[model samples]
Target: MRILLVGAGLSGAVIARALAEAGHRATVIDARAHIAGNCHTERDAETGVLVHVYGPHIFHTDDEGVWAYVNRHARFRPYRNRVKSTAQGAVYSLPINLHTINQFFGRTMRPDEARRFIEAQADTSIADPRTFEEQALRFVGPDLYRAFFKGYTEKQWGCSPADLPASILKRLPVRFNYDDNYFFHRFQGMPEDGYTPVVASILDHPGIDVHLDTPFVSDMAARHDHVFWSGPLDGYFGYDLGRLGYRSLTFERFRATGDWQGCAVMNYGDPDVPFTRITEHKHFAPWETHEGSVLYREYSKACGADDTPYYPIRLVREKALLSQYVARAAGTGNVTFVGRLGTYRYLDMDVTIREALNAADAFLHAVQANARPPVFSADPA
Candidate 1:
């Protein structure tokens, strides 16, 4: 079987490797000059620090199989993502931990005390919170919401928290204890060398052929027995139903002599600060030491035609547009829309890999059973 993978990112690479191992010829193509998609990493020419070309991507997952899969390909150094925020003229721990709660209000309250204090401030009137603002006010009250989440949310999504869905705010946890780690995953780490090498290794099979800087055309689909589309969902359909909204990111790079922020990610919670967060790349790989440092000030904006899409803006408008695309994809044949862009959902690296693996398994099972492969391996809705 000849398989065509539209994008040479994690989804494409993982599925390509799986299919190739099962005696199928896999051809992976990407419009970009390099593989690994947005997670592509390269060493800074001047500073010698390995930089995340797009942005900081810390690999963390609770799935044991996914963890083992990445570990087999590349040496993963244990890296915990401890995020910080600067708001109201002071630096504080992220996720609104006990320390952050105490510092922000100038009170040294214990865990139970802090919990009760926040509870008293919380709005009990909002019975069923629908929007981001209501959810924040219900949980942490107005003052903390204004200081930490309100400004940051406005800048990140390019809309008031009042307009955004409450689910967005629910994704982030508010800790009563002093746990500042961004994620609560059982396993967390970064590739020892970089993500590109890890992906390169996955696509290194004899049955696989990779072509960089090659965009997939409608004509290309006919050449393959099956197609795994990891590119944008609307892109697969030529956006006939209208473009889905997405928030694109632009990084402003700068080099420094020593440690810049003494941490990997320092977010600016103030809306006045144009950029959302500043990431120090050197801190990502703590095992390796470098005299010089490299950092990026990440700015989020509405995605344009030419801009690289980072975060999907799945508001009311985008959801309606996405459903149309999903229908179009279903009617189309011989192609399985895979990965974040294909499904039009923001996915973690682990979730992306897990889905890729599952998609490959489903395809193989379908082939064995002499049945038609699914149009989508995962539900876009």
Candidate 2:
């Protein structure tokens, strides 16, 4: 069987590798010049710091199989993401932990004490929170919400918190303890050499052919037995139903001598501040030390026709448009929509790889049964 993978990211690469190993010839193509999509990483030419070209990607997941899968390709060094935030002229730990709460209010309270104190601050009136603003106010209260969440959410989403869904705030958890690790996943680390080699190793199979800087055309699908599209769902259909809402990012890059922010990520919660966060590339790979540092001040805005889409702004309007696209995708034959963009969801690296593996398994099973493959392996709904 001949397989066509429309993107060279984790989803496409993993599926291609799985099919290639199963005696299927896979052809992987990407519009970008590089292979690893947004996860693409390379050593800085002058500073030698491994820069996450698009943005920072910390590999963290609870899935044992996913953890082992990445380890097989790349050497991963133990790295925990301890994020910090600057708001109202003070630096505080992220996720509104005990330390952050205590520091913000200038009160050194124990776990139980802090929890009780926060409950008092919360707005008990709003029983059923519907919006991001209400969720934050109910869970953490006005002070913490205004200081940590409100401004950041507004800047990141390019809208007032009242306009965003409550599920957006539900992603982040508030802890009574002082543990400030951003994620609670059991397996957490960074690729020792970076993500590019991990993906390069995956696509190195003899049955696979990779083409960089090559865009997928509509006619290309007819030439292959099956197509696994990791590109945008709207893009595959030529955006006839109108463009899906996405928040694009713009980075202002700069260089420093050593230790710029003293952390991997430093988010600005001040609405007046233009940029959302400043990422120190050197901090991402703490195992290796270098004299120079590379950083990017990230700014988020409405995704334009030319901008690189980062976050899916799945507001009411976007969800309606997405449903139309999903229906069209279901009707289409010989193609399976996979990955974050294809499925129209913001997926983490581990989730993306897991779904890709599942998609490949489903394809192999369909082949065995002499049946048609699914349009989507995971339900977008």
**Distance from true position, residue 94, model 2, in Å?**
0.8
How high is the lDDT of residue 32 in model 2?
Answer: 96
Error of 1 at 7 (Å): 0.5
TM-score of 1: 0.99
Task: Score each candidate by Cα lDDT.
Answer: 0.94, 0.95
lDDT of 2 by residue, 51-115 (tens): 99999999999999999999999999999999999999999998779999999999999999998
lDDT of 1 by residue, 1-381 (tens): 999999999999999999999999999999999999999999999999999999989999999999999999999999889999999899999888999999989999999999999999999899999999999999999999998898999899999999998988888898999999999999999999999999999999999999998998889999999999998999988877889899999899999999889999999999899999999999999999999999999999999999999889888899999988988887988999999999989899999999999999999999999998988869998
User: Which pairs in model 2 have colliding backbones?
Assistant: none
Q: Please, what's the RMSD in Å of model 1?
A: 0.8
Candidate 1 displacement at residue 254 in angstroms: 0.8
TM-score of each: 0.99, 0.99
Off by over 4 Å in 2: none
Which run of 10 residues does model 2 get worst, by summed lDDT? 372-381
Q: List runs of model 1 lying over 4 Å from the truth.
A: none
Tell me how many clashing residue pairs each candidate has: 0, 0
